[model samples]
Target: MIDVVAAILKQGDKILIARRKEGKSLGGYWEFPGGKIEEGESPEKSLIRELKEEMMIDIKVTEPFGENIHDYGDKKIRLIAFWGEIDSGEIVLKDHDCIEWVFPKDLHQYNFSPADVSFVEQLMK
Candidate 1:
């Protein structure tokens, strides 16, 4: 199973989301910034590494907001989500095509991965 971490970053009433690049799994879908956990790394460390690689920013990952598990065809993932705050640097899209700040209630407007949809639902509750 893939151990993944997602950052649920908020600025007041809005949260940051990113659109996956074309040709990637769940392409065109929007998701919170995160990636798979590397071997021997803690979830928080993995989140920090992913944010730096994908968003070019330093983030302070907080305690997990929640966790979700889902299967996508050939693979299953265990998602560990955290509420984070930006520490430095602007959000420069490096891996994703684009990024947006969205309200929690308005998250359903865009398409999300099956697993991510559940994560968002948990956030809304």
Candidate 2:
């Protein structure tokens, strides 16, 4: 199974969400910004690294928010999510096609990745 980490990055009352680039896996689906956890790295460390590498932003990972295991026909992933806040740097789009800051109640408007749906549900509640 692929091990992944995601950040519920917050700015005031809004949370950050990124859309996968077209032609990529889960293309056009929105997700919490993060990537696969490298070997030997803790989930929090992985999230910090991923946010930097993908979005060019440093984050302070706070508490664990939730986790889920999902199968997408050929691939299965264990996705771990954490509450986080951006600590520094401007946001840059390297891996994603677009990004948005949205209120939790408005998250339902975007089509999110299946693995990320659980986190969205938790946030909306």
Candidate 3:
């Protein structure tokens, strides 16, 4: 299974979510910003690097939030999620079509990637 990491970045009462670029894998679906973990990298470090690469923002990863493993017929992924906050830099999206800061209660309104649905349910609870 491919290992991935995602950041649930918080700013006040809002959480940051990004829309996958159209035509890409899981295109048009909203997800916690993150990417696949590279070789020889810890999940936390991978998340930090991914935030900088994908969103152009420096993040301070705080704690583990949750994880889920899902199969998409073509592939399986283990999604490791963590809590984080922006440390610096303005978000300049490089991989996403859009980004939003949404309250937990409103997260259900967006169409999220299937691998991320469990976390969304936990947050809504």
C-alpha RMSD by candidate, in order: 0.9, 0.7, 0.5
Q: Residues 1-125, candidate 3: write the lDDT tens digits.
A: 99999999999999999999998999999999999999999999999999888878899999999999999999999999999999999999888989999999999999999999999999999
The candidate with the higher TM-score, 1 or 2, is 2
lDDT of 2: 0.95
Candidate 2, residues 1-125, lDDT tens digits: the string is 99999999989999999999998888999999999999999999999999999989999998999899999989999999999999999999987999999999999999999999988998999
Compared with the true structure, model 2 gives a TM-score of 0.98
lDDT of each: 0.89, 0.95, 0.96
The number of clashing residue pairs in each candidate reads 0, 0, 0
lDDT of 1 by residue, 1-125 (tens): 99999999988889999999998878888998899999999999999999999888999986788899898869999999999989999988877898888888888888987788987887776
Q: Pairs clashing in candidate 1? A: none
TM-score of each: 0.95, 0.98, 0.98
Question: Highest TM-score, which number?
Answer: 3
The alpha-carbon lDDT assigned to residue 116 of candidate 2 equals 97
Q: Any residue pairs clashing in model 2, and if so which?
A: none
